[model samples]
Target chain A: MIRRFIRLLLLAALVAAGFAFWMTRAVPLDEDALAGVEGDVENGQRVFTAAGCASCHAAPDTKGDDKLVLAGGQKFPSNFGTFIAPNISPDPTEGIGDWTAAEFASAVMQGVSPEGQHYYPAFPYGAYTKMKKQDLADLWAYMQTLPASDTASQPHDVGFPFNIRRALGGWKLLFMDDNWVLKNAPSEQVTRGRYLVEALAHCGECHTPRNMLGGMDTSRWLAGAPNPSGKGRIPGIAPGAFKWTEGEITYYLETGFTPDFDSVGGHMVAVVENMAELTEGDRQAIAAYLKSVPEQPSE
Target chain B: MKNIVTATVIAGVLAGSAALAQNDGSAQVKARQGQMRVIALNLGVLGGMAQGKIDYDAEAAQNAADSLAGVAMIHQPTLWIEGTSNADREGTKALPAIWEDNADFMTKWDAFVTAANDMQSAAGTGKDALGPAMGGLGDACKACHEKYQQSDD
Candidate 1:
């Protein structure tokens, strides 16, 4: 009876390992999805600033966070564990130098990293998926302009179940959408705002609520989510909490003040400082777009 | 009775002179002047650090702490004063609330000074004691910010 018990335990361990392996398998990239776009690297740099990419990804020392300029070592803490952001710099040995443009697009739009692995939503690919193909190409081109830094990426310090990358496939199946841009075209301002908010800045990654499985709850777009950094709450910017006029929002973006007369603080302080440096038109577009979003609280 | 009358006259003269000195407007002028007051304090502290006057010198550290306290006390008020005036230049995100909620703002300003003084007192004891004092100062910042500041995100 003791011998039989030991065998049963061994079999269960094998099954669990197999299950873990299966969950992290990389999803296939659709090569044709990002075809046919006239990309401009210069324009992409402007879009990148509008999106606020450098706010989180770039090292504090570097002036900006270039997508291909990954100088890794930023730690993202979540419910499961700490996820170390990887080096996406164009280094042949340690970064994405070998990735094809389609593979890069797939990772950004589909949440699938190179090597067929599904990336955890910690990368904010969910919002990035809404980027237009031309925009993605431009971002990619701009990334290529960055000087390569060969920083070996750190491994994520996740707990047991979450450590399994294969499980992310199921998570993606439930939450991931491969489309790189929103289907409906609203006003040009709204479209521009959506592109900046959803694809570029990935604002919802901090502001939107998450589901039990740890994916973003799409139904409640920008209605404030708990900060992944485990510090203070990342407040919601929906109409309910902040019924800002377009001018007020624009002023805040340009100068970091709310209509109520409070200056932005914490992580957002850096964001506003960066926004302050952007073109006035881009700032206005973001403000107009944010105002156009439907205001609803998180469920 | 004559001695008492003489003493009263002397006291009256002293009181008048004190009032005249207080009304000289120097303090108000210092408070209303540009960002120089805060900038001066910052420079003094930096100079102290550079000269090794702050390393382990109890008296120097105490003086530095006192200077910081004085500046901290007037910091928010100056912001309110300057922010309300034409000095409210562009690139300054000082919210209008600084002037609108003056009472609560002053209270927070007072708390920050108290915390900063405590830090300086601790720092005078030793460099190692500075951390806890800094923590108190940080708490003061957070307390006021949570209520009054907006998220930049």
Candidate 2:
């Protein structure tokens, strides 16, 4: 009777292990999605500007023209651990210079690394997954044009359980969806705005609150989160809480001035710099989307 | 009875000094904000004219620029006393980084002073000139705030 019971226990454990292995497998990008789109370098610059890539990838407090160098040593402290931004410069030895377009797409859109490992959602691939393939191609092209740095990418300072990249596949399965959070687009402008906000700009990555698993709390989209630094909360920009007119929002994006003339502060300074590079129409579209998003109180 | 009275008096003195220390930090924060408000008001005048939301009155623009330059020149470190940052005191957006990185903060202040002086000269020129000068001034204000302030907006 004891021998029979031990055999049954071993069978159950084997089934459980198989399930865990399958669930943690890395899922690569769809090949069909990468077909036929050519990288347009000029358009790629627009995509890069909109995405605000340098905001994190650049060395912290990098100023002036040096912001273009993607050396990437900024440390983002989270409940999980401090995720260090990696060197993405076009240095063959240290950066993504050796990566193929398919590899890049998998990393950016699918959060799968070249070695078929799951990347932490700290990279914001969850939002980027919704981006148009054309924009991804363009952004890839633009990134290639930037100056290379030999700075090696740093490993993230995460500990047990969270440090296991395979575990992130389960998190991605739970939270990563290509669906647009906003369903109805009232107009072409709003639709464009939605694309920029939801996919390209990835405004929700910072503005939206998250659950214990670090998955974005979609119901509270654009409702703000606690500042990762723990100094204060990042304010909500949802319709109910933001209280800024579309015009005011656009102007602020353009000039970084509040209606009362207070200047932009903190990390938003880099964001405004990127926003200012975009066209007035793009800024207007962003403002329109902010106005249309579901209302939520600030965190 | 005498010993009891002595203990009560010492306790009262300690409490009084603690309250005074808290008040001092708050007062410094208030004064620092008052100065910043002055800077913002002048920037508003120039910003409005640059946007053409307010009429481009050369005299008003120049006056605002002059006020900005004047405030920028004032070496008011007393207004930013140690332990008066947002982390230490309530109701102020000033970050402790201001104290932590005082040299960087001072360099930003110097840059603001330079930009303000430039704005003063540019404001007297036509609206076209005023627009570009305001851009420089705005950048200086932005650079400092990005490092030393913890504003939500």
lDDT of 1 by residue, A65-183 (tens): 34336667777778989887777776777877788889988887777876777787788777777777888889878777776778788888988988777778778767777553345
Off by over 4 Å in 2: A1-13, A30-33, B1-23
- Residue ranges of candidate 1 with Cα displaced over 4 Å: A1-25, A31-38, A64-69, A178-186, A297-299, B1-153
Residues A1-299, candidate 2: write the lDDT tens digits.
99999999999999999998898799887655677889999999999888889999997789867888999999989889999999998888898999888889999999998889998888988889988889899989999999999998889999998988888878988999999999998889999999989998888988898898888999999988888777778889898877999988998898888888888998888889999999999999999988888889744
Q: Chain B TM-score for each model?
A: 0.51, 0.83
Q: List the residue pairs that clash in candidate 2.
A: none
Model 1, CA-based lDDT? 0.65
Give residue A10's error in model 1 in angstroms.
20
CAPRI band of model 2?
medium
Candidate 2, residue A276: Cα displacement in angstroms equals 0.4
Native contacts kept, each candidate: 0.11, 0.74
- Report the Cα RMSD per candidate: 17.0, 3.4
User: By TM-score, who's the top model here?
Assistant: 2
